[model samples]
Target: MGLKLSGNKGQQSHRLVIFAAIIVLMTLLILYGSNNVNDAVYAPFHVATNYAIKATDLKKWSGKDGYVPFHGNKTMNLQCHNCALVTSSSHVLGTRAGKEIDSTECVIRMNDAPTLGYETDVGNKTSLRVIAHSSVFRVVRRPNEYLQRPDSNPVIIFWGPPNKIGKEAKGTLYRLIQRISMTYSNLSCFSITANKMRKFDSLFHRETGRDRQKSHSWLSTGWFTMVIAIEICDNIKVYGMVPPNHCGKSKPGSKKMPYHYYKPRGPEECVTYLQNEGGRRGNHHRFITEKQVFSRWAKQYNITFTHPNW
Candidate 1:
């Protein structure tokens, strides 16, 4: 009887060891599955951001001409007028308040002046680097006609608003857009305004309606501009940009520096949405945050992000 009992006890011990082994294997399988699921979930966001940066690469778009294609093959054109040019210019000389006699230095343009043109050569054969008035520029076009990406033509960056505030600048912006449009029939124009931006908004007063100073006062139309640029371009080069003083303060006579250009009225309300999540749901307009995300995404997708500050 004692021998039989001992034999049974040994068998029970063997079964217990097998059961524990099964549990350990199951636990390991669960851990591996959970990790794979997490990776799968994050894969798309990584891919999208990577693809966006790759879309902005010049090498992928470069042709026989020295010109670089704007935004991969996708044209995400933004229009701006008198957005303000904080460029490097010789400082005005006056012997005042210092022993240093009239030393030349960089001077800031505090007022809205003439609009600088981005000259496009005839037949879309020639290329020129765009120089402008305000560091943060604006572009205007019909609703949804924000940018144009052509196969055979040079990519053009646009800046200027449609209103009479800066007519010549507006004209210059239109000229640039038309030049690109003339060459590329299917240029994608992405209008960045809060209110309706119909074609000929700048040419005809037909598109204007309500001012955004009242409702939804925390959104920056520029956010739309950036989104379009990021989404379209394979490689993006940002130059002459002012830190996000979105009230259009960079421009002359901009009262109260309206923080949100998308709202119905200016300074009517100070909402968190104005400062964060204005254009893209996940985007905040902080300079460092934008720079970091853009850089990482660009690098991952082999796109270069260049700032003119250097």
Candidate 2:
């Protein structure tokens, strides 16, 4: 109130204040960007490390009052050094590839996908089965003779909504899985923890910029199974999981490709699901985007694809 500054001097002071504020803002942004870069670099390793620790604890968790029921006999260790992930696709039936698929040290199958009638195409061996809660009832209750076969005793990893496994819930599928595991020592059942699922959900969103939670959709069984394989295997070979564009499309020879080789019928829903992923009429699953993620992973990890383009 006592002294007044010249107009130019006042203007210079204001400019200096603005400059200082800009410097502070730039510093904060630089720090934030650096943090994000670190996260981007280390996130996958963090998940892998967590998975490795959890896998080691799996043996301990097989005992009484543990999440996984104990195997009546010794636990069958998964040998995934050079594993083959056999997806439930019809393309796997082509070119007498079943023999090659069976040659892998470990062969992982999806859902209740059968290999009995289609043994010549899909191979007769199943080391592990990745099952979803929705399909549990069908796999356990179906009258298929293959479901009861002793050789079909694949270690089962089941995943689903948290409510399905809650103590008070009366879900038949959950109860059936429990009953089957209790009765059959050969068929061990392990539920993927809710925390692990959420971690995977976050990782998918961070990697792909797509959030399944926002769409109220869950990760496909194939995607989850692949993650498990990556954790355990040094070499991973994928069969029958074609890129989305190849589905329901014709080849250069004018021969049309079916969505699934097992179900050669027209208008396969899987093809339609892939086609409509990001269209005006969209689907819950972002299959094409998932394929893109897999392609990137294939390049980074020891992963290869067979039967149609990856």
- Among these predictions, the greatest TM-score belongs to 2
lDDT (C-alpha, whole model) for all candidates: 0.31, 0.66
* Worst 10 contiguous positions by lDDT, candidate 1: 118-127
The Cα RMSD in angstroms, rounded to one decimal, for candidate 2 relative to the true structure is: 11.8
lDDT of 1 by residue, 161-272 (tens): 4342132334544445445445555443222221323221221111112122221122222322333343343434332333323322335544332222232244422233
Report how far off residue 116 is in candidate 1 (Å): 28
Reference-based TM-score of each model:
0.27, 0.69
lDDT by residue for model 2 (150-230), tens = 766767777777568533453765677677777776676776655666766865766565566664445778777877777
Q: How close is candidate 2 to the true structure, as a TM-score?
A: 0.69
In angstroms, how far off is 114's CA in candidate 1?
26
Backbone clashes in model 1:
48
